[model samples]
Target: MPTNYYKLNLASLPDGLYNQETDVKEWLALTTTSKGSFPPDSLNRVLRMDSSVELERIIGISLWMVGNVLPFVLPLFILASILSSTGLVLLKAFLTYVAVLASLNKFIFAPMFMKRYKRKQLSNTDIKDNQYLHTERNNQKYNSLQFVWPESVNRPALNDKPVIFTAIPHGAVPLGITCYPVWSKLFNDKLCHWTCAPVVLKLPIVSSFMKHMGYIPAKAKHIVDTLTKKEENVGVVLDGIAGMFRSDKNTEIANIKQRKGIIKIALRAGVPIVPTYGFGHTSLWKIVVDPFGILEALSLKLDISLTPFFGRWGWFLGPPQRVPLCVALGEPVLCPKIDEPTQDDIDKYHSQLLQSYADLFECHKASYGWANKKLVFV
Candidate 1:
């Protein structure tokens, strides 16, 4: 025979009781038939309640919805939508628009967006005003040495003629820097063709930085077309951006887990696979592994980290290790002109590319400080 009011006041009451109370209140508010059912006194009191407190609660609910519920619900909703005629049409139209927008954004709008975003983000932080690094006038001083260039002594020349280089993500080496020197030295010396990914041209600070080093954003098709003119040195990163996972002194190519777009591009373009490695690249920063063990994939996708070289040994460009940090320019594997490449062809080339990388790693293991490390498949 305990009073209902006393039961509501107890701290030991189940959380669900509070939830049920809230639901009842909501239902009561919604289903009010007569004005007196919701007394003017009660309505006035509720209306007069702290708006800031209500707002905070709403925000918390919204954040929970977005962070937890939306991820699973959105995919299911999209799937259900796809099963309907209107939904399918809308989805198709949306996808087409998104694809077009992505292409345009990468090639054009991204640079501007990056610059604006960087400036805004920096302005909000307590960063010091360094005149040399930040000012437009000091841009020339920053251009003293071309940081991005090839280590090869016999660097090919890139005349006004365009040459294409696919920027890959192996050894976590930002090939952009190494490739710059290659382009300038090769193009300046020989005056042959040179080109690279259009995405590079659209990076805010990076685009200008690249242009100064003599690289234009070149399409893959254009690169192949240019190659047909003469024996063109079209460079490509076999392990695209996923190469960033490689641990220091690890001989195994960690990039095999990802898609081999570079292989496809190489096969289509008929370019020789250049198995390259960069020593002391990953040592540039510290990587935090997922603690929960559940979000590792998502964490990698987001790349949630401090600045590229913060709280660790800042990056250093070693004098390119010709042997181990090696660029094994393998013999050109001729590709057939086919409408669709077979899986076997893809697998064969992928294996060859992987073996070439392993061989190069083995050949220079001692010099690069990876002699003791075992080549892990993953």
Candidate 2:
């Protein structure tokens, strides 16, 4: 549900009767135009439905369905139908044709969409008026997507420097990326790009959507070139898929002990690296365990996440739990430009990034109500 729907109150109605479609239609009609009349049962349904339920559904569909289920499942389904069905010769041929088209669509379609992605300058009023920013039911403050920095750190230092925001505990999904509207506001709507694994970038519709959201392939060449050629900031998941494999509600882990590529890129690009962490991201969804580690091995091998089953409240493939998302931006670690960075340079800066990220987590965990949470680096 959009944030505005959370404001409505349908009082004095019977219990256990709700219809989202009817209520949304009526709401839209009332708010947007008088062209359509409300359905007869709209009031009754509106009164029965809790705003939280709708919010959960929205979170589930947006995060789980869009980010996880659809992209991986659809292509696998198409390929399985094409290969395993021995009897349907004609159908197999058609499915094969469709698969080719989907693969081709991956390359041709996403760039066209990317070219048309426009950025509009937002005013103070525009940022304040954004309903999504106010959608955090857990917190009344519009700072649902909070960015906390150390008291000693200057805000303009972060604002002026071209940075590589290294986010952690990749969570069930990168919920931080989904909050583009809020974070983009923090950067004054300046376009910031994030790097993603090539596996997801090859899926049909998912690739286009990711491209529109400023995701590029997580290749060293691509990251280096983009940082060198563009004036915008770049974001990288230090833990990447390996970090996601370790994501659990009970145990918070960052698989970044060996991840030194981003540090090298930052040094080469002459940009500062910001150790970014998102609180409440891991609590959003619970991952079902693969006791034998088959899924884990496959995930690491393919460089793509393959959680066989995951959701909130034991609902398989359902929406993640509703929680206010907050990202902490640590003091930027300066990386001087080295046309050809050495092993010693990478090692020194990588240690700094780890310390900076750990410091960020320790300093603000209590403030963000994550006092008991500890970030373990694997």
Candidate number achieving the greatest lDDT relative to the actual structure? 2
Once model 2 is optimally superposed onto the true structure by TM-score, how far is the C-alpha of residue 99 displaced, in angstroms? 20
Superposition TM-score, candidate 2 onto the true structure: 0.66
**Model 2 C-alpha lDDT versus the unseen true structure:** 0.57
Model 1, which residues run further than 4 Å from truth? Answer: 1-179, 183-200, 212-232, 248-252, 289-308, 311-339
* Residue-level lDDT tens digits of model 2 in 1-378: 111111112122111111211232342222221112222222112122345434434442444254444555556666666777653554466456445544443454333322322223223343222212212221212113334444323333456555677888787676644544333334333356688898777876666656656677889888877677766677788787777667554557889999998888889889888788877667666776688988888888988777754555765555565555556667678999998999999999999989988877775566556567788888
> What Cα-based lDDT does every candidate model obtain?
0.37, 0.57
| C-alpha lDDT of candidate 1 relative to the true structure | 0.37
Q: What local lDDT score does residue 97 receive in model 2, on the 0 to 100 scale?
A: 49
Rate residue 133 of model 1 by lDDT.
17
For residues 129-159, could you state the per-residue lDDT of candidate 1 as single tens digits? 1110111211111111111122221123223
Clashes of each: 23, 1
